[model samples]
Target chain A: MENRNGCKLVDLPESTRRKDRFSFTLLVVIIVLIPVLVESKYYLIVLNIIGLNTIVVVGLNLLIGFAGQISLGHAAFFGLGSYFSGILTANYGFPHWPAMVVAMLATGAIAYLIGYPALKLRGHYLVMATLGFGIIINILMGELEQFTGGHDGLIGIPPLSVGGLTFDNDLKNFYLIWAFVFFCMLVARNLLDSRVGRALRAIHGSEVAANSLGVNTSSYKVKVFVLSAMFASVSGSLYAHYITFISPSTYDFYYSIQVVTMVIVGGMGSLWGSLFGAAILSFISEALHVAKQYHIIAYGVFLSLILIFLPEGVLVGIQHFYQSKKLQRLIAVKTPFLLWFNRF
Target chain B: MSNSDSILELVNVSINFGGLQAINRLSFQVESGQIFALIGPNGAGKTTAINMITGIYPPAEGEIYFEGQVLSGKKPYQVTRMGIARTFQNIQVFQNMTVRENVMVGLHTRSRSEFVRCLLHTPMVRKEERMIRRRCNEILEFMGLASKAGLLAAGLPYGDQKKVEIARTLATEPRLLLLDEPAAGLNLQETHEMSHTILMIRETGVTVLLVAHNMDLVMGISDTITVLNYGEKIADGSPAEIQNSDKVVAAYLGREPW
Candidate 1:
């Protein structure tokens, strides 16, 4: 059968086509109903957290998944954003909105500066440079006590207000966070579908080929690096405003690893995969309250299980399974028909 | 041809890889709407010359002019924007992407829009996007790949991958197209088809520059043939002159002919 676009799915065996259609429908339904099902204030809080995490994961996805660049220091950008916004709002008396904007810009600028030298390094060297950047930020967060509020972390931050309305409660914050998350997802999707996204993917597949294709590979790399940094900064701004507090400990290397895990566990190079990954992992971390004592151990076990059984990640595995089932169904339906038709 | 008719002119181009000279003062002109062949034995710097012409490597000496515009210092993408597109000796399709998506990438240079237009799905952007897709489909159909548009490039057979690469280069709407070893892995029948395709591409007013080792295929379709050996040009003339050149035979055989 052909889809409305005149793209033929009949060429794909019946079982395979059926599964594809079913899974696509299922995905759409889930996306449409997620907000409606999240009714509880507590669950809404969880969703807001998911939204914040999704932003960082999407950024990390562009860097690691699309650009084929590994960054273990993204938390540096996150922490920098938080500190930048916290300082501006707390000391400069800037509004939270402008502070957030300034914070994102600051993070992007810093990323662009560091990317010039950091992007020159490849593979393990790149990892080292990023790790060094993270360590430096973490150290600065503590040492710059006069500006950053020291180890006690900045507190008593104001809520985000717009047009005489303040998002002071969990419900309001949930909508705000989710709106930002949706906007971010839209941006990420657009970037993935645009020329820049294609160039990034081409570089990921093979940088040499990408260069030959007339892509300025080095410049594109730096651009994605800065763009992803800005994305992480936005998430950081949301976190600071929502909690009304900030700490260096929160935006550590461990947090960066968590974000990377979310992207990888979702399915590298798949935007929807990153969302699924963020939701599943974040849910697991939150749901197992008793396992909080061994949260690290629990996280390790969960990640290990995902890596072993679903090496391509949960979303990719699900997609593969759906496709195979669809193919089986298509063959089952069409084999006899083909034989009868052949007799004619 | 006059200077205006010649889309790409490489004047005394030479590229040195460290101590080794890959292309030694090589010069040629690709007039618009002609198929020009560059043939050489293994390690004769055929790909190296194509690389320089396509902006992957800067010539150690010489100037490249495309449509009266100097292209020596320009980047590869800048060259592409100037309407020169090329394929690799090894098949270089974006393996993870579908064939249609791969072709769509070639259309990227031609697209005119900011990031905001794509994000908002503005009517104009959508219209332009649809037009590009339609054109991509047309190119695929011309290359006999309409049915496999949705297939991941890596899944396609070698011959089809080669065709997809050519189709992608065509999507750029280039004035000059360069093919590096297009018939490298093809069977005799496929090579015949490739020759026909090359002719078809030439008929479309796109200059063709083919680098190949297959003499029979090269002799069959090339309007002008240039032979290279040890980074130096050995022969430059019509296909019949190339076939009869003693220097060409000596270069291919590694010895002077009787």
Candidate 2:
């Protein structure tokens, strides 16, 4: 029972760790190099949109997957960020980068204020509160025409700049957006691997047990809420700058549901799953756009199929398949090795 | 009792649920380095008393002190940080987490590194993490769970899950540990093993307060026993004294001498 460091080392199966590292590195390499290889501006725009959605999904995953909290109004925060940036830059003549920062901080503050009370409600009650918040924000965007430019939305938003270079081209903006997404992913990865992440998992498991272990569950819940909100805000800012036009309809409750569906279909509580979810769902929406009347139906069918076939989500399903194969290989190798040793 | 020596003291504690009085003005003291047992029948308020002690409920009429600090108003997590840890009667292990992860989570209070350090993977945080890992392993080994440390908590057998829960509680490094029905689902062999584990915990000089219905186990290990009937203390004495007391038998049998 007594060890030098005071804990036992339960060795993880080496193949699993190797596969994790390999997949993570492979994802980083592909994301980093994709912009260089793609020549089509349209394709780059799609990639940039995927990056933006990835940021939002990552945040949503923290709330729904790790903390086990339901949020049906997250699109309200996204809409707020967009409108905040759009209003500040369009009317006040503020620079785009500075406006992004201000929007993020404002969204984070709003989330903090709302989360304090919202976290007290659990399950369906929490979902209703979040939905109410979304509806209120959407209605305000519509009613406050002068500030949000009414239903038409603010147009001609100034392009983002870094050190005097404007990110006006799809290629430049693609690089910029993906860089930000990568940073967001890194922050999320670090948070999920830290003490805060562990606490969130414990709360997700059983709040009573978490409390008995001395975890401040309420505070952690609020903190995660704020963090997730900030991620959404950053994504919103990217969308505002990239599209250069945003209507109230873009940030509706339907959009929030789409993001949630992505996370669920990709795999809950997994970082890679968030990214995969965004990519798959975004592709589905684009692929069906030509069949205008059947687009929504096709999207619904895809979501249902994924839910039924892989309830843990696509990423987990794939990971499980790889794991079982690796285990089989290990067993195959071990049997022969054991037989050889028996001869001694 | 003197303030310096007592680890936990309940002063006339009582709990009420509408018309029912679950615990009626109960008073008890647990000193450092002692094993105290609370025994009673099914409806005798044993769990209620434990709930109050662990901050799940505030006493309807009195104060609870831990390490000479008033504990009546604190939250459950606050009480745990103040050096008290407890296990539920029904198993409440973090079912989705790995066995080691569950124990590591319990070690949350012991690590002093800030969130920033953990996120950055700073040298200090890494060093502290290694220390925590070591300590958690020691606790697992103590509970004879070193072999199954990598398995998810829900995948373990019933007795092992109970052991993991105890190990998780032990990782909190509480001065006062309260176990509610630790032997409830355990077989005879497991019950014996648990008795040994309790003795080992006592050997570490931590005060343990157990609520149990197993009369034989209680009588064998407790330095002092408190018997409850209808939320009132019927008797409080050494094992031999409690065994000979007429009130204890009468309370257990639900009758009095003719």
Candidate 3:
């Protein structure tokens, strides 16, 4: 329930802090226990991909849910990160860690340049801009042969390593990827709870109102765009290293659509919804393998269903469902007393 | 050219929408601590004038000076930082946010911590956030919406939503506040409450400039009234003076002989 008093921070419920703590604790327990319980490399790999996707979806949610801006080209940013990190480390012999950082910064810079102009004008300009940008980058990834290794794809991307240890197998990479996922979620949560977060939600709620209140809406929009892009870049780099291979197809339009679907299905504005979205969608896609050619259609159907029934996404939808069920029970209990009182 | 007490001065300001002029040669001075009203029939460019003042649309001619700084090219947020804040005629409160969060947005210009600091939850940012929470509470309490702080703004009644918008603007600690129709859809009681709120805001030393169609509200509280018609100012004086002025009376109702 909400605080209802002016004493606490606005909009944030009293249990939110406790709930977040509990969720984080639960996540840690799951992360630590999953590998031991599952014992299958295939499942671990799937879980790792979900973790990587979670990071990007969470970042995308900030732009989509908080700023009410959409990017159909995030897959391009994802590609850029993979190609940058993969090409730099595998081809140029750069260290893996620095390559990842460089990839993120470069992606952030690119997002800024794109966001600065696109964000100035209101409405669906961003959607069009990102759509065009994603296609161009995906083309460049294939067309550039020497650097990217062409359609043959970039190979031999080194798994991340510390001084003496390396994440080469599925289980090790699982820990590595999910570790990043956990950290990314924490960062996103922090941003959401702070002043910047509120400014972002305000921009989403109404850009005019946000501007009137001294929010540099354009700048903040661009900043969040860059931040989300950087998040995608990190996930992309992890994806490249874990898979030990990179290709333009991996960051194609469908992948972008998939993650966007995840954002909506999980809950547009909910952080944990991003996780559930990525997990559920990724699992569905994997499970739909028998329908190979029809999987995209299946995704379309699933997306339509979610939009129709759970427009707020799965997280908030479930919340409303739970709340209403509780309310119904309370009313049912109170009806008998009301009927008796009516006779008087 | 304005005296030291002039908080905002519009000088020969005009704007055009394509070939049509929305406001023409309009000039007014709101002195410090005055409750000024700009009243006119619909489509008289009252909102357009407010837009120009708040830097939503720059005047095509002349300048708007806030504390002697030219506001022609400054962005809306820049005008806010310069201590000029405004509310929309149609309420523009952040519907998804809580009433307190809406007010917290008012502190955007005042609070210094940004993305990195807020993400890290740095000592300085935490300190600033604490200060912001305290200030938001004070604002909500002052506006008597403290009990509704945690409620989503979209869920509040229309009158309370109006108060939430004003409370949010107050959080900006603005020197000059432009309220566009502060009492538009309100009942008599709500309008009375709004007038009291405006007077209270003025008592705190903030200059109030409102655009309203409600003659009772404009007459009841305004220290000065400026009447506009067809994008031109027809009369300017105290409420009583404007009420008695032939031009002001003609603008509201057509000539009796006609």
> Which candidate number has the best lDDT?
3
Best by DockQ: 3
RMSD of 3: 3.7
lDDT of 2 by residue, A68-160 (tens): 987888898888888889999988999877888999999989988888887876555667777888889998898899889888788878878
Comparing candidate 1 with candidate 2, which one achieves the higher DockQ? 2
Over 4 Å off in model 1, which ranges?
A1-44, A120-126, A287-294, A325-344, B1-5, B256-258
Error of 2 at A210 (Å): 0.3
TM-score of each: 0.89, 0.92, 0.96
Candidate 3 has which clashing residue pairs, if any? none
Ranking by lDDT: 3, 2, 1
lDDT (Cα, tens digit) per residue for candidate 3, span A72-139:
99899889999999999999999999999999999999999888999899788999999999999999
DockQ of every candidate: 0.34, 0.53, 0.59
Q: Is candidate 1 or candidate 3 better by TM-score?
A: 3
Best by TM-score: 3
Shift in Å, residue A250, candidate 2: 0.7
**What's the candidate order when arranged by decreasing DockQ?**
3, 2, 1
